[model samples]
Target: MREAFHEQLDGVFDDLAGICRSVETAVRLATQALLSGDAAIAEQVISADADIDKAKEKIEDTCFQLLSLQQPVAGDLRVVVSALRMVTELERMGDLSVHVAKIARLRVPDIAVPEEVRPTLARMGEVAEDMVCRVEQIITTKDVEAAIELGRADEIMDGLRRQSFAELFADEWAHGVEAAVDIALLGRYYERIADHAVSVANRVVYVVTGDFPVDV
Candidate 1:
């Protein structure tokens, strides 16, 4: 009976890991679609969102089943309960990626980013993507140290977000309001990806230590 329960727990872990990887890919591919104005890629990201949702649902259902059947205690309970919450954040991250891709598709053949802001957007995407990857590692390895450090990592994304906003709101800004809105929304999407990644790390800390990090 104990072995069967552990197997079920292991299945939940595997499913959660798959979610982390999928959202990471979504963010990266959305960035590509944004930069290149590739409708095809953007469409692909939009469609791939279904898979992320399905993964989250599977984890949530498994968590509910475990909580009901196995009645996990202490660390096991933490793992099951935290997973139910973490998948919400992960799903939102996936949605943010879809938001980014929708902008690319909205503009169709035209690149969503203005030339002056391309480098900043690129940096935002890279940092946000890396944050997700790091969060995944923290979740799998239960690295409390990395989870604590995750907040510091978010600073890079915040900085880039500020830079993007500055360009859009600058007096010399030539892009019209329509373009300005796109830049603003796109920057926010990247920033939010990092934010969710940090949230994931926070939940990971809770799972491992039974306490949320004060800073992360």
Candidate 2:
């Protein structure tokens, strides 16, 4: 029975990892579409978000089933509880990516990102992707230290967001108010994605160590 329970637990981990990968793809594609004005890629991201939602539902269902049937205790119970909350964060992260893509689609071929802030936005996306990838690793490996380090990665994302806003509000800014608003929202989406990634990593730490980091 314990073996079967462990198997179900492993399955839960797989589902979480799947959600992470889906979110990563969504964010990356959304960033690309926003930068390059690829409406097709934006459409793909908008459509793919449903799959991420479905993935979240799957994990939620599995976690509940495990709790009802197996009645996991101690560390095992913590794992299941953490999985339930972690999927919520992952789903929100997925939604943020969808928002990014929708902004791209709404603007169509004109591109939502201004030329001056492209590099900053690109770097922000890269950092988010890296942190999300770490989310997958933390799920699989249960490395508490990796989860802790993800906070540092989120700091990088926060810095990029500030930089993006500075560019938007620069004295010589020529993109105009509409573009500035668009990029500002885009920066927020990226920053929120990173925040969610950190949240997911903290869930992992909670599952392993049974104590969430104070900052999270």
Give the Å error, residue 201, model 1: 0.6
Sequence-dependent TM-score of model 2? 0.96
Q: Which tens-of-lDDT digit does each residue in 99-136 have in candidate 1?
A: 99999999977888889999999998889888999988
In model 2, which runs have C-alpha deviations exceeding 4 angstroms? none
Which tens-of-lDDT digit does each residue in 113-197 have in candidate 2? 8788999999988998888999999998999999999999988888888898889777989989999999889889999999899
In model 2, the clashing pairs are none
Cα lDDT computed for each candidate against the true fold:
0.88, 0.90
Model 1 spans > 4 angstroms off = none
Candidate that scores best on TM-score: 2
Per-candidate Cα RMSD to the true structure, in Å, reads 1.3, 1.1
- The CA-based lDDT of model 1 is what? 0.88
